[model samples]
Target: MLDAGICNYVAISYGHSGLWGGGMRQLLFNTRPSEACFGHFGAVGRYALAAQRGMHEFSSGPETWKHIAMGQRKWANLNPAAIMHAKPMSEADYHGAPLVVEPFRLFDSCQMNDGGRAIIVTSAERARDLKHRPVLIMGMGQHNPSNEIAQARYLAGPTGAHKAGRAAFAMAGIGLDDVDACQIYDCFTYTVEITMQEYGFFGRGEGENWFQGGTIEPGGTMPVNTSGGQLSEAYFMGLTPIAEAVMQLMGRCGPRQLGPETRTREPQVILCSDNGGALQSHSCLIFGRG
Candidate 1:
């Protein structure tokens, strides 16, 4: 519609009900009879299990995921809208969480919530007249591999974010150093780790060192998932991260807001990622202050 100049503004809305009795697994993973018997079937646990060995070796061990899960939970503690906002967690608490899948504790998985969200998109000129600070879309990229996770190339290998992030950075004419924050898709804790590594935020096998010691949490050098992310906040799929990035850039999130007002470095550039279908599909969007 924008390409045809049919409208100058667009409103995107998304809603889902994972909390309801509806069976999302059946809906999303409708596999053929032949594919049903495959090793990677049904829920995401199997897929994560297949990659756990390489992930543990590359990122050090299962302990590395604790940082991601705990960090985001802390962020959630400060966001009233977050599902986990009232639930505070500690390192000890993270360690004690029961295993949902091998190498993945209960905290590693995102919760399903029923909610609706909407974001408005308009031309820069039109946005300038709006009440709030306009978040500019600097660059965007998407990549989806042809093969399934059963393929050797995809299982425990590079994700679509590798290429998608490169294209986004190239289009934006910026390096990883320019990113002030990240709103990485966190359907699972390890998802954030892999996406960051693929985006070159850290070199191969350096995720453990980079993520440890509260590097990506509030008051850390680079705050990530400031709205608590899908892991702690309500999961709305890709919308969770994308919406949070906009609020952060606009300096609108109260209490958990990122900016000089909160004694945190003002975010000028934000990187957002949306991963889908067992890391096979990825979309990278770079947003800048407008």
Candidate 2:
């Protein structure tokens, strides 16, 4: 587009400014999700809990969420402005937390805090002229299904990442093996676990083993959500993950930086996913250092 004399740059931003203070309660009440609703349409807590519980046969166990909480909390310590920065978490704390809904502890839920985030798009030529090292957007893909919760196939519907991720990989001219890190849109701990699989980070139904040995933690084989994400970081829909990906590619994430364990090194390619409407809308982007 820049070559065609179109726009020079594009910026995408989102704000849950309503979460700034008393506004959080407003979100819970105003969204009008039913208490009995499941999946994306009901009260956030009850729905996410119920959906995961019904699929117990695929359970990754409590430790799955525990690691997610632990890793994200560690990143929180690195982020002075993270909502959970002042509150550290431990495995004991996760185990002790009361269940807000069956199969879901309080720590599993995302923090509903006020926040804003943005991403910028520009041509490679303009990027070179710009001050900061540009994070190249190598690939993009999206897919959305209109099925309602009641009408959708259980555990079989395309929450879309399958199609999106495949398309993204195709467009990027790379395969999943090339991705070194991920910035998943984690509205809940399970969101991270499930999405990683759908995006082809590992074989289907292998999350239990795939996540073992700190693979998703800092300095691990494949780092994920290094900013703590919606679980321990502020939630602003998908923008937080998008911004974190930009920072990761830019080598701007301070203590939470990934790649090499003891030192800061940027990944050559990172995959970021954005989800919406009860996992109905999906978009995947691959960013790289050029």
The best candidate by TM-score is 1
Model 2, span 178-256: residue lDDT tens: 8878889887777777778788776655776877767777667777888888888888888888888888878887767
With a 3 Å backbone cut-off (N, CA, C), the pairs that clash in candidate 1 are: none
Positional deviation of residue 138's Cα in model 1 after best superposition, in angstroms:
0.4
The RMSD of every model to the true structure, in order and in angstroms, is 2.0, 2.9
Question: Once superposed on the true structure, which residue ranges of model 2 sit more than 4 Å away at CA?
Answer: 1-4, 20-27, 30-50, 154-158, 261-265
Clashing pairs in 2: none
- Model 1, 1-290: lDDT tens digits are 76578999999988877777475555345665677766334545545664575575575446778889888988899899999999998888888888766677788888778897789999888888999999999999999985465563654447788899999999999999999999999988888888888899888788788988888888888788998899898888788999999999998998988876445679999999997777778999999999
Among all candidates shown, the one with the greatest lDDT:
1
Work out the TM-score per prediction.
0.93, 0.88
What TM-score does candidate 1 reach?
0.93
Give lDDT for model 1: 0.82
